[model samples]
Target: MQSTKLVETRGLTKRYPGVLALNGVDFDLEAGEVHVLFGENGAGKSTLISMLAGANSPTEGTITLNGQALAFSSVADAQRAGIYTVFQEFSLIPTLTVAENIFLGWEPMRGPFVDHRAMRRRAHDMFEELDFPIDPTAITASLSRAQQQMVEITKAFHGDLSVLILDEPTASLTDREVDHLFGFIASLKERGVGIIYISHRIQEFQRIADRVTVLRDGARIGTVAMAETDEHALVEMMTGRAITEIYPQIAHTPGDVLATAEGLVTSGVSAASLEIRAGEVLGIAGLVGSGKSRLFRAMMGLAPRLGGKVTLKGQDVTRAPTRAILKAGMYYLSPDRKAEGLDLAKTSNDNLALNLVMGGTGVSRMGFINWKEVRAESARIADYVELHAGYRPKLVSQLSGGNQQKVLFGKCFGQEADIYVFDEPTVGVDMGTRSALYRLIQQLAEAGKAVVVISSDLPEVLNLSHRMLVLAHGRISAELSGDEMVEELVLKHFFDESGAKA
Candidate 1:
């Protein structure tokens, strides 16, 4: 029996003014199958999908739907042809309600006036069918990121869906939310809907994907069955190098305690206590909303601390402002880099220099700016973070996810902070970038700096940290070191409600 080809692209190529975004890429999707697009950032995955979704026209290519050659001029044209794409960056209007955002352009109307009752009912029915718990009447802005993502996914169910493209759909979702999404995908597959799934999370491919296509430097590397290939092979193909070690081995030599949080309390955190010592990487692991990030955020004054005592080098700074804490030599790297870390409108060089200027470092003197010094120092920092010199002058928004993370990492070196806290530092980045960042963290710890890493990735925390803390129910459930940091033991403590030590 022959399966239908829902969509196909032959010799697809996209070219910009001076760069070839995608080159001679051949891809296809079959009905009732999940085809994954796996590659590093800037590997032509976005460009290929954009052309298929009619967001951009390829310089040269041929697209065929169900054996009929067609060219889509706009996103609406593709949508009309039963092709829907859920982009990574949300297109929802914050001011509008969930139902309104779902059916923005095509609204149910009662004689030119939108029928609010019918729209809400249809939205409710759609969510009920998908088993997604989201209030259709809730304002899009008021909902959590995970709920907003569900709204976006629900929008695809508005009309006849033949091809569904999901771009990093589970990036903001929790474990339970991800399970629900996977179940939904299973239903779609059973209905003979071809799905194109794009994600940097390789572990998910085995669960959801039937076939995986690897792209590199705007070229198609190869396509293989998901069951036949392993993570190491895929990583090597995407990075053109056999990575012997993803997490760098660092010497754990703990010195005097550099920072301590005694009885830290916040809206998300109950009572938590921890210490950051010099020349050690202290890893914090927990599920989403388990107070892993909240503990440090409250101590740094980013969030309100209901009650806590934060001391730096034996000096109390519990009531100090965030700026004061930063000035006192503590650098905190936010997980949400786009919103809280970097200015999208500013150039990478400018962002790094901004930190130096604020810290009154060599980039500025006596309330005056030094443009030449800023460029030199920013370039040095960029190189240190392995960011190419060509990207320094470009806006941070124009760079890929990995490069943008590199720019943010470079900003940390602007000021000589003794204590460094990284929250989900390698969230959306690729394997190669993760290796580079891990090496940089190792270097920092080896230099006698107090390093604290808070991550949702279990393997990341277990492999990198000399001492690992597991948080559960808004409190520290267990603190493990050496052999105690195994995956089984950590998983056991992740759900501990009594906050008892393992």
Candidate 2:
């Protein structure tokens, strides 16, 4: 491992018309070191990385590489300069084979002829080097999110990447997959690759990062050695407050059955059905690709309902589309908040007012969007959710994860839905924001709304759920309620051999 500075940025600043996206930030990446960039959403981490990737040019400041100043005109230029970035969104084409995507532009050529065999061999070798078993000939669409991520990383590192940028690489990965990714990163570091790692999971940072840098509201807080600071102290510097409690439990009396499904079946599952009671939080837990998400989508009509009878408030409603199901007082929040919930390209006001405008409130007049009415209702929901800066007209991508979730909740709060289905609502948020979300969910139940929180986080499910269901291999393996809230019981019931048969 070399002790040379591979990349450095000084006085980096980027400003929009109304918001300063990145303040005069100073950052450096040493050769062969894994440096984690820690911050909340909209903490300017993405902007900084975007600039580094040559996706966006910095409004001010200078970037130096290996004691020489560098200017990249585009992402291609950045890659040519030996810097590669893997964003949260997989860059692989879903319809293309993994090998085709890996050698997309730089395929090996033999005497002016494309060498397909060489391409596949190199791609397979990359996977083998990383100890990943993904098939290079398989279509990218057939691969799971984790597999797709591996493909993306392989593509990024196929060539010489002196500095690699990974944004939330493990957010969608399972524990095993995360371990694999970390192991690959360690290998890359040993080979003298500097990595700029970004993640919301603070616990993992201490495990992998040699040094840590904190940014808040577009300004650099400070950079420190990982061994010198703890996650709590780092969070305090990032958010300016000590977060003691992440999840706060609230009590509520259960009410009547708000929703029920009979013989529900979708393409993703066989015979499946469930019921949700008013003021009840049903926690659903499962591994990735375990059909837990499918069940939620089927209930909300996001998936094709093969066979089912859904009833809301005693009204028989079956085989309805997403719009109809939502109209019938049911709503669903996606785990992918940025891609599915918020419109990163649009302003916060528009994203928060999406349901209101679509539902034809005063915001919609004769199929026309009334900007004034939309803005007014958005302001109300933003206040209710206590969003910072009271309805930021800025883009939704420019907000923190906790704050973005607040906007998502604000959008849904405007709709009068009797049942709310939340899928991984706290996936990438911090402890404080997660606690606030739990409080909000409790408030929703107290207001007589039946809530189904689908999450993989065991502690989150145990703390917030009144009743819990475990889905194993597209089937409800276990159901526990009332006094049966022990984590050990849930695990054994969900994974034990007899539990599978039972």
Candidate 3:
């Protein structure tokens, strides 16, 4: 391990038209050290890193490398300087193979031809070094999100890297995959590479961070050695207040059954049976590939169902398309907010007005469109969801992660459906927004709307749901209510032998 500063930022500031994304913040990363950049959503973490990575130019700041001032004109410039960042949203081309994507733009060439064999060999070597199992010839689009994330990381570290930035790298990973990622990071740290790790999961810091820096509302609170600070203290520093309990117990009174699945079989699940009751929240907990998401999609006919029966309010709605399912007053909230939940390139009104248009409420006469009326309804729902900056005309991409998620909720809330299905609703949401989302779910239940929340977050599912279901290997293994909904027991059923049994 080296005892030298690899990178430093002094008075770093980035400003948008109306928002000061990052203030004059000073930070540093030491060689061979894992420095965790801790902050809530919109706290300027992304802006700061983007500037450092040359994805965005700093409005006012100074970046130094080995005591020399560094001015990166573009991401390529940063890459030449051995600085790399793996952002949450991947940048891989869906049509390219994993090996091709890894060496994209800088592929080895023999005379006038690209050296495909050499590229595949190098990709295979990189995967072997990390003990990562991924087909080099597999198309990027065909890979799962977690596998795509691996491709991104492999691309970032393909050659030489003095500084590595990882933002929410584990959000898409399963527990075992996370272990592998951490082990690989450990090796990088031992090799004297400076790493800037960003994650909303507080529990992860203690495991990999050597030092932690807290940023709040664009200003740096302070940096503390990992051994000197605890997770509770770190949370307080990041939020500027103690998050007493993020998960609050809500007394939900479940009413008559609103939806039910009997002897259900889908592309990834089988023999599943459950009921969703109005005025209640049903929580589903499982590992990443355990078929929870598949079950929801199959219910809506988004996935192929081998055999199953799904009924909404005593009406058997089997083998129905997604449109029919939505027409039946049931809505699905996508776990991947950016990819499937909301269209980032479109205007806020356009995205927020999707459900209204889909439900035929955006039209006036003879299939004629009334964008004005749709905008009016959009404004109403945006206000109800407390949209960022109050329905301003901007692409959904301009909003922060939390606000983008809010816009997704707005788009879905416009449905006014009898039942709502949420998958990882709060996956990338920060503490404050997560609490607000919990309240929103509770409000839905109180208003007699049935909700099903499927999350990898155990405590969140336990606190938010009135009745909980655990799935393993595509089958419902345990149903726990009230006293049986503790985290430990739910986890046992989630990973235990019983969860995989039919």
Clash numbers, per candidate:
0, 1, 0
**What is the alpha-carbon lDDT of model 2 when measured against the actual structure?**
0.83
Candidate 1, pairs of clashing residues:
none
Off by over 4 Å in 1: 363-365
Cα lDDT tens digits, model 1, 341-459, are 99999999989999877776663345678778877888888999999988988999999999999999999998879999999999989887899999999999999998999998887
Better of 2 and 3 by TM-score: 3
Residue-level lDDT of model 3, residues 1-502, one tens digit each, is 4479999999999889998989999999999899999888889899899988988888898999888999999988898888999898788999999999999998989889999999999899989976778999999999977789888878877568899999999988888888888988999998888999998887788899999998999999999999888977987887666756655566677798988888789877878888999988999998888888999888888888788699988988886788888988899999888878888888788887777887777686789878888888988878877775554488889877788878888887776699999989988778777876777787788888999999887767877888888998888889999899997888778765454335
Model 1 TM: 0.96
* lDDT of candidate 2 over 55-122, digit per residue (tens): 99999999998989988899888988899999987777889899999999888999999898999999
Task: Sort every candidate by TM-score, greatest first.
Answer: 1, 3, 2
The number of the candidate with the highest lDDT is 1
Q: Give, for candidate 3, the lowest lDDT window spanning 10 residues.
A: 493-502
Each model's C-alpha lDDT?
0.90, 0.83, 0.85
Global Cα RMSD, each model? 1.8, 4.2, 2.6
Query: How close to the true structure is residue 169 of candidate 3, measured as C-alpha lDDT?
Result: 92
Clashes of 2: 1
